[model samples]
Target: MNDKLDLKSTDITSLNIEKIAALFPNCVTETAEGKRIDFDLLKQELSTEIVEGNKERYRLEWPGKREAIVTANLPTTKTLRPVREDSVDFDTTENLYIEGDNLEVLKILQESYLGKIKMIYIDPPYNTGKDFVYKDNFAKAGNEELLESGQKDEYNQKLVVNPETSGRYHSDWLSMMYPRLKLARNLLTEDGVIFISIDDNEVHNLRKICDEIFGEGNFVANIVWQKKYGPANDAQGMSDTHEHIILYAKNISFWNPILLKRDEKQLAAYKNPDNDPRGVWRASDLSVRTFSENCYFPITGPNGQIHWPPESTSWRISETKFNELLNDNRITFGVAGTARPMQKKFLTEVKDGITPQTWWHREFAADTKIARYEMKDLIPENVFDTPKPSLLIKRCIEISSREGLILDFFSGSATTAHAVMQLNAEDGGNRKYIMVQVPELTTEKSQANKVGYKNICEIGKERIRRAAQKIKESLNQDSQDGKGLNQDSQDLFNLGNQENQANPGSDNVQANPGSNIDLGFRVYRLDSSNMQEVYYKPQEYNQATLDLFADNVKPDRTAEDLLTQIMLDWGLPLSLKIERKTIAGKEVFSVAGDSLYACFDHELDEAFAKEIAKEKPLRIVFRDNGFKDDTAKENVRQLLKQLSPQTEMRVV
Candidate 1:
């Protein structure tokens, strides 16, 4: 067997073309300028064609440290991640649903979406004395003996979760989340923000973690959402009805979320009871910021009596502005001129402020029941438990993201996807999503298993499909009733079409006469990580030396093509050349500008091997099972060093 190439021995920077090709006089020749060149010396060169064979792949080099450190072994599973492709999807969307272990999915996205995400909302396992599963190394579990005894399998490796009841509850959760958080940090764009939802279980810990990950300087407000309008009925002591959402940003110095728009309900509060030609208005304060010594003087009302300021809260404007309002009758006092002066605030003048107070569930309720209902309606009953409300998701998305990309790795029930569709329907906006999910085998005792689902990801896709169907149905219903919701139905598909008609199939197909909504989300399933290639089986016929070698006729394929493949596998640049020639009734190929040479004629001679190796390619790889003579192989190795001392050779 040939040893692996000693990569350490090949110094790319030290290579010099002129000096190395000097030894192989027959195989190499010099140009007029004394530049070394390989002659057409017939030898088996690297195969360019992707033949039917497994390829040995290489990975990026790992940095080495001198000291060895002991670490816990953890179990891990190959997690699938998502990628988004640019395409038209309805008018606009902003929600996403990812269905995978967020840790792995986040890592997979680090390269393509680093520093790009705006908001990240996750409801992780509360770790309330139950086993929270995450992929980890198994060796730390004393499974080395089992592995060595062949009691364990490789592909079906199992990862164990540390239950929260364990003494290291906090430690375990932190360890599991650290790397994932590190990766997620890279996905946040500079001005991006993140919102994490959590219960008391680890709210403090989560805050500290965010402070570390997003930098304490960027820590935004901690919003306390009234997840439940009523208190928990079965509370041991106190009923908990609220949850905290910790907000942070990639760069607080530049990050600012869009203020929530006031709904029509709020707008309906103002009325123009006394039409003053300024439209509808609300009453505001009329007092000055401070009781100005000069302004403390009595202001005569329409009755010409002294009007005193209020006891505490003062006005935002100066007395000058107040008098101006009084002159324009913008300031209103008592019904019969007996009340204190009040400024009139026109509805048109006030900017919609950020939603007030930390408590939000009052405005946006978290009816887990509603989410469950949505899931059951879309998928098999009880396939999933807690799903964040679409309203909650839509709110978060509206505040943080524009018409940009959204990602969800823990896409349970696909609520985020539904929210994106619903929000887009509400207000036209285009936002894309990439969802990643793992096909973790379903537990036999789980309801989803009874329904024949393999895992959560399966349910996730079904939910998206069903949601899209519902959205289309709802939009179509609206369109038939002559509602604006029909705008989203622009992509309706009809049944009839000529098989060969090519106007970009969907573009030419007319929408169903009554249809109203377009199915917007595209689904993709992630497959095993592998670079696919095609190959052919080598011919079975065996011949010591055929006329193919004797006539110096080359294979239809060129050596340059084969060399390119070798470079791909070797992780070398593809821009290398080859010189070909016939040698002793055999064809040989020498890498252009390099000492590398290859031949697989089985009838190779020792003298010919010496001549080829004389011009040392930095490294030479060959088929180990191909050489016919053991003595000749040994002689070739000995002569390789003699002819090209610096060349490292290998056989595979």
Candidate 2:
């Protein structure tokens, strides 16, 4: 077998040689006599091997380490595709709408976004008798099947649903979820938090898994939301309408959960109509927890008759506290001289302490009626089913992430995204959202699928579009006075779209195109090609010459952009070096960084990638796309792979 495989190494290191072999196992297939032949067959195999090999190497190598200093005038532009009437691109806006298996989508996200997310909220399958389990190829490693699908095997199923009867019910759920959760955790910021909505079927199991991922110490609370208003009328006796939303923080110390505000609406319940100096307050009986002998003692009243306290009841506060309250004029006696002594609960003096309870009643959260109404209002004739109320999600966002990025991996009907948009609209705060949903083939069995929708993700995208339009229309209508139209015409996604004039009017706000106007989100699909690869044309011109040619094109500036710099500086092709790489330890594009020894596309396991990033190059270039694992993506070499691994890494 060794003789048949006539493999030899040159200047190429053992690592690169091994990488080449892994890409093509049949590089040295021979005849029975061990005679070499079939140059055509060998060339075809080698060419195919090189194609995959270069992509992997390009993804792992850094451009900063290259010997040359010439610019790489490689193409840099995204490929926009039409999806069911909508055009999507990477620069559309900050919000993202991916249409594919969420697991794969999460894997792709690890490259450009790791440790950058602020919050994540997901509503996974409950796995009840009717819940479908996801089939993940846990036995296989990496994304080999994903990369080779369709082109090689049309019959191959990338993803499938396992029935509830499978013996590996819990195992299957955990297996399918483990990798995704690990990846999701990487996307969170140090001060980030995640909320998972589940039911009795796997709440305990979910908690255990989350504890393993987010750490047990970060567990926040298990909030129970009232899903319905009335009790069950069925024969079994009881109806369950509530579900649980479990919360966990990336780091508890960094995250600050907000206290529900004591707004005017709630404060209106208290009254000061009688002009009492103590301010607005209500009345309550001052009670004790213990059968106190001192509290039970009889007291002399204005009527001359001595009144003794009830034998069974005692004051709520300690004797010392009660005496202090009496001394401070806080304790109130009966309106008339004959009433029992009570205490004035002044609204102004008390702190509005919000204790998030396990049972979420209708008053605290949006009721089912409101949830249904919200769906009907946004969607005509109710296109989707069981959409969560904006009010409910708004409360969650306000509590968990008052000001940060919010993610919804299971963005059913884009409820969480809509909630984030609505929150931003109300407070005028810039909060971004990234949504992921599976484009599972839809059928008539489902209401949304029946009405022209092909998958759950389609409904999600449409919902966001229609919802945004409605939000915009409402904002236009609610403007103060007649100047509402011009007061706030800017979009929710586009920030700083407005321009500033040299001399501004007292109330004049500059209007900038594509600025204040919500440019709508810049959307990029997980499978979409990187801008450089799509635009690069290597066959027509040599990249080395392209960099030098720029001088003739324009000599006034005597400077070049990253693309040109990469071509001249590194013998590595402009299309390759100015790519994505693992610098120091994090995933970044090299054209954007200033470091020597550029490992343009550095794999998470590559020590060379970290070493080069740690040594900071004048500039590093990397393939716009690379890295398949989420956990490994966060190891950024800010300066050193250990302490400062963050280097400038740009996508061509």
Candidate 3:
């Protein structure tokens, strides 16, 4: 995986560090706070030296627009910590469900997921004047300012408020979304596309910023989706029945939407009324709107009636083609034998699919009513307001990806994940998803709180678990009763309510295994770096701080936490298959089968290094204090070199 890395300018700070490390590996040493450059050692190595975005994004500027730019460029010391208790198939699942502020989460995933995501769909808050809790101000001067300013959620994170009465109502919402989108663009593949769902509140403003961020040429469409089946009887104003979904691609030239497959209702239009041996066919108008003197010929129907093109219109085909069609019995007349000639469109002669239109009806894309039904089917309580139907999101998935990575940063009830699972089950595809949601606390007076769902994340995770159970049960019932639901697995989107349903286990794809309809997702909560304390100066520092860090790595942090940090630092995906083993009285984690190896135990010797090097892993990482002394650290590296010169080793 680490063969000649691509020289792309992404995550500037980290990539430059890697380049420096390559040229002077000794200068790049691990500290308690993760990797750090050893300046003194680097000075020796150089004696000589070391070698190591967007334009006019402000087309329509808001109050906090500059702060939004600063936020996107800022570095985060935070890292994702694994939550095994809340996870399904922790070490095996390829799907990810992360709980954190999406802005920070986007920044953290930049390196690992950069330009890898195929499609992104976010249904963010509509800025409807509600008193929505917001993040700490990016432009605020200091922590004291935040402490004097906003409310802290259950997790103790500072949160401000945005209300209709506030002066910066629309500006606040735009600021919140700007940075997130800026970072998200980097995570998309060249052929990637993003769909954002918004209502009238900020749709116009959203378009302006999106045009600046994604570029005007990348603009695809502003689909008008029917969100309601009927109008509200209450006479407040014209009842709002529709919302907009804006589509944009990473590069317009590199991508195109997949045509929608013809459904049963559309296909039913065709029938073999004449019992033609060719196939079932439907009558199509054969007149052209534009005037063409050469195509103004009349046609003789099979019923011995003469037919002419409609008034002001000409025949679509030339006289020669019309004669050929007449000879082949491809023209049709009215059942009464007095109508004009029409062309017969055989089902077998047309394309298998139809191009999608900008207009989406509720029949194909479920409305708000069905969305509530789906939420009730799983939680049976009003945990979310204005939830989107899983089928609605499934429509987006169908248009976006057939088998690729899908991301949903504003995953409220996790409808995107639900849709992905249903689509994969139906087609036997190997699509994977990553859902990120902030653990927004439920108000004490809310139904979700009364039902014991403390936060939105709790509800989201529960929905995925129950949805998986529902899919698995459906598959099983089909196998037993032979109802053939497996072929029509999209029915799973219905996700019906069942009384006394037990939460069931899920399946995993491992990080590196062959893809499947993976039912499980790994859980990770964002937290500060695992480093307890780090030392800087080489001899004046290395030994003591390294020893202190090894002896204690954040009392609250576990070995898995350390492993995850290492994964991020190394640019290895956190989903890689990991195997835990104890060797020479030390705990070693084997990641992706010899791609990398790590041991954190104290007193590591040459023998232990030799044993591990026997397999010749691509890289090895060890805790600095894992060895007896400075002498022992050098000895282990030397031992590994003698045994497996192909292996790269590092000490933290």
Candidate 4:
């Protein structure tokens, strides 16, 4: 296979254009430059009615709107390099923490994670005139720019700050968000949902863009979360104490958000005062504001006084149904039975939990002060400026997702990762998380820099480490308190035990309940592809140049690097469990328990090939130069065909 084009991501715009051309051949035309679409012809082909050009239409527009579309369509030549030293559990964890520009990271993830993510939660810049926005240079090649940025060094890329003085202040923020949201929408499953946190700064604009991207029909709700407890005393005018968490579903009809668990106060409303056989029950108002002639009836109280529906009001149910309900003791009155009759909703008959409401009070979800305290408790130094409380994110996870992949491209402070771990601990879920953050550098004299955090990504990674330890400790304590570890925990601990046996003296290692939880994540850093440029453009090289570039892979790349690239090419998840074993004195990497097997050794003989073939992996890969000669390569292929006819074999 050609390595150059095959290594890059799919060109989304070209595919879209091909789809359009297939439908309307007449509208597809070639220009002096390249293939071009005739808008007038396409419009005519789409509809028989005349389309007016000057007519006013309802649509969101900005200075860089067209450019934003181009950005999302462009394919990147970037790849994620595994950082084993930075990872918590390099070979076993199903969670991932990606450090890079989220836009490039999203492009790299498109093939492997498309339509697989169940929920996405992002807290992007609020565009408060001081926030930084990514400056996407569509003209430049992605690989060249990424290389020049020095991926391994301290983050020094200049982030564009959209100050109020800039001519395209609002436009810049919108432009930055437009393409990212479009890409994010593609990753969501059919029943998936996305929650975006934003303040009043650009809430209206955000809603318009989301309606266009996710469809107006899929718009779920605009939840008003009390982010702060009380009004700011130093406010110039009215204090802004709340933020909006806009939610949208991939397919609204298919999505059924789980109900929120009932808190003590909500459960307290139900009482078994009368010793009813149906357990505890709560009273509900029986009157309705709408004038329903059929429901405009009354009932006689136990005190022998007749009670009629209040003025301009009617019973919630018809008189016939009310009679049946009263006969079944589904109606309630005051303690003395003198007040108006009400409907009785038995706790046992109702759902186990309560439906989520649009307004989230600070008491249920934590406030800003509580969030700060949480950060302070974990890390003595406050590195993040506005770290969200874990409870707030926990609620979002509980409602939208259960046991599927969750992504957060704009994962500031890694709050989503922390919340995912906490929720998994509570409910024994196998939910996994993918957190992507741009390594935006901290201020020179800021607390983060002084405390040894060079960039935001450092703070985020550290937070996950601390959060995992804390969760494991808490779970272990619970186990000691006689609440034995759940099944999920036990399974995780067994896996951890197995891993610990393989690799000894790893940090943060614990026993029993602590080991059962997957509090570890694989870390990957975004960088240029492992293949050298000469591999893609071999025709430009002469005999001497070709000799120097004989091996298409870069000199610095390792066996693990090629394995990761193969995973991406094959659309395998980066978090898949990996194992390395020595067969016939040759090291072989096994991915996902025989789903894929690869040997990147420099030299291979017949014995090693036969040993690998005997295992019958679904897919196998080898280095082109690994074979001793042409005879060796043919022998290995013949052996594999005989031993495992179903296995797909490839060489790099």
Q: Candidate 4 has which clashing residue pairs, if any?
A: 493-516
Give each model's whole-structure lDDT: 0.55, 0.56, 0.79, 0.82
- How far off is residue 646 in model 2, in Å? 14
Q: What is the TM-score of candidate 4?
A: 0.85
lDDT of 3 by residue, 199-291 (tens): 998999889988989998999999989887567788488989999999999999998888777766677889888789999999998998987
Candidate 2: TM-score? Answer: 0.60
Please say which candidate is ahead in TM-score: 2 or 4.
4
TM-scores for every candidate against the unseen true structure:
0.60, 0.60, 0.83, 0.85
Q: What order do you get sorting by lDDT, best first?
A: 4, 3, 2, 1
Best by TM-score: 4
Q: Highest lDDT: which candidate?
A: 4
Between candidates 2 and 3, the one scoring higher on TM-score is: 3
Once fitted onto the true fold, the runs of candidate 1 whose alpha carbons sit more than 4 angstroms away are 1-100, 138-161, 286-300, 303-307, 334-337, 352-357, 482-528, 531-652
Q: Name model 2 segments beyond 4 Å from true.
A: 1-92, 111-113, 138-159, 235-237, 263-265, 288-313, 337-340, 444-447, 480-519, 528-652
> Per-residue lDDT for 300-358 in model 1, tens only?
77777776666544555667877787788788875577667777778778876445345
lDDT for position 236 in model 2: 75
Q: For all the candidates, what are their Cα RMSDs to the real structure? A: 23.9, 20.1, 15.5, 12.2
Poorly placed runs, candidate 3 (over 4 Å): 1-58, 131-133, 139-149, 154-158, 334-337, 484-516, 533-552
Task: Show how many residue pairs clash in every candidate, following the order shown.
Answer: 48, 75, 1, 1
> Over the stretch 274-317, how does candidate 4's per-residue lDDT look in tens digits?
88999988899999888899998768888888988889988889
